[model samples]
Target: MNPDKTLAMVPADTLVVLDFETTGLSPNMGDRAIEIGAVKLERGQVIDRFSQLMNPGFRVSRFIEDYTGISNAMLAEAPSCAEVMSQFAQFIDGCNLVAHNASFDKRFLDAELDYIGSGYSGEFVCSLLVARRLYPEAPSHKLGELVAYKNLTHDGVFHRALADSEMTAQLWLAMLADTQKPQLSFAQIHKLSKTPKAKVPLYLSTL
Candidate 1:
């Protein structure tokens, strides 16, 4: 139950890069997710993908609209997080989840899973952490900034679920190269997440 193992290191196979666009910042404050995107990797290759827009049962902010390009009208036709999380949980089953700022996405996801009478406690790898550990000399650690620093391009427009997920995937590949560690298996990661911690750092997502 060593907290250091949460993401201390990993092997390079069966990773799932995930991203979420939520109605607002605080999941506990009623900010629910409106979109989700995920890409599954096996042995350094992307083998499966998942993307869906969700109805958060609320309105998206003007700022959010401008940022993510996901409108209320677009969400009206989408499924609820409860509906999609079920499938998403399955999609990411037995894989380590990777995200740029993971805590943000994880909090919203954990709350949604709770609401659905389920639990989503899994091992997660933070790209921001990798950035901190590997590129401590970098001026910025924001995903877009990191992408630019790495000289990578976002194939799809930014902010959308699938596009963001794809960017996360590429970012993960770059991180793998930077960290020089193989991807970890689900068993190894889950044990790390479940272990108790004395002082959990303010996760990258919150920053």
Candidate 2:
């Protein structure tokens, strides 16, 4: 199937909003995901959750520990990366995925899943990219900024996987609500996300 048709097959509520706290940037540079969090939503309501901390087989730097509050000592007793990712892969199976800056999460996800001999088939939606197109006047498109910009409720915490994922989910639903087109399919929204900001209205009008 074409990409749009594949995305259209997924129901809005079935999107898996996810986040990863990693050892560092660029999974290709040997950075590994130290924690994974995801929420399954249906019709803008959260239906399920998955959260886990993984032992990356190396000590996380003090900076990372301070940033994420996930210490190496804490991860010492956690499951191995392979173990947690195996379960995560199953949890997100056959579901569209969403992340704030999806490229970051997508890189780690693909790398980690590749390490586990697994992969997801569903398309990924970048809430950040979509927000940029949908709300050009907003001061910033950062997840937290968008949260505040849209007056979306959040726990006031950032960086940890689950909290960020939940916030991203809310931001995503808010973006969809702002679109004012409830009838638009996921594929349609996905297409709009890739359009230049100036052309979004024109594309939506065509829809």
Candidate 3:
């Protein structure tokens, strides 16, 4: 659970796959997350869900509103970011986290959690990075693209937190299923993902 330690394999039972819909690209620029959605998966099945819209203490631009379908009016009625993150911290307790393009989510997650004086112990896995290694032949690695390439079901929506998180969860599972190495530990798979793609087969053969 050390933050500095990368996980070795996909969690076998419980983990959380999450997504955030934000006002802009960088939390460092003061853009805040407008909505957060996550699915708790246990043994490849969704066991619980958490979704919330948070007021960012500022109005979002029309471009953001349009892109995310989350208007300023909708955020006006939502709880403050602190309140939502406080509960989110609880929701993710003792669970590893997975996110597509996890660096982006990790930045926002750490920022929001730091602001609330809270934190989680679980390490985060980047499904994006994993997919790049696992599916090098795929034309595109975007969440939606991977979903279709893997033939995962979706509700035909993107950019929203919950829907995107659901797609990410499916993509994560599909990638794991494709690994063909059920005996590999989570740490071993994590190590395999970080290995150069050309060397993956060599590493796996040794495993």
Question: TM-score of every model?
Answer: 0.80, 0.95, 0.93
lDDT of 1: 0.72
What residue runs in model 3 are displaced by over 4 Å at the alpha carbon? 1-13
Ranking by lDDT: 2, 3, 1
Name the TM-score of candidate 3.
0.93
* Model 1 C-alpha lDDT per residue in residues 117-197, reported as the tens digit of each score: 776444776667656655666789888778888888876478887787788778767765654334444443343333333
lDDT of 3 by residue, 2-61 (tens): 443543344533589999999888999998889999999987899999999999999999
Which candidate model has the greater TM-score, 1 or 3? 3
Cα RMSD to the true fold for all candidates: 6.5, 1.6, 2.2
Global CA lDDT of candidate 2, please? Answer: 0.89
lDDT of 3: 0.86
Better of 1 and 2 by TM-score: 2
Q: Candidate 1: TM-score?
A: 0.80
lDDT of 2 by residue, 1-207 (tens): 675467676655558999999999998889999999999998778899999999999998899999999998899999999999999999988788889899999999999999989998788889999999999999999998999999988888899999999999988888888887777677777777799999998887886
- Inter-residue clash pairs, candidate 1: 11-182, 11-183, 11-184, 12-182, 12-183
How many pairs of residues collide in each model?
5, 3, 5
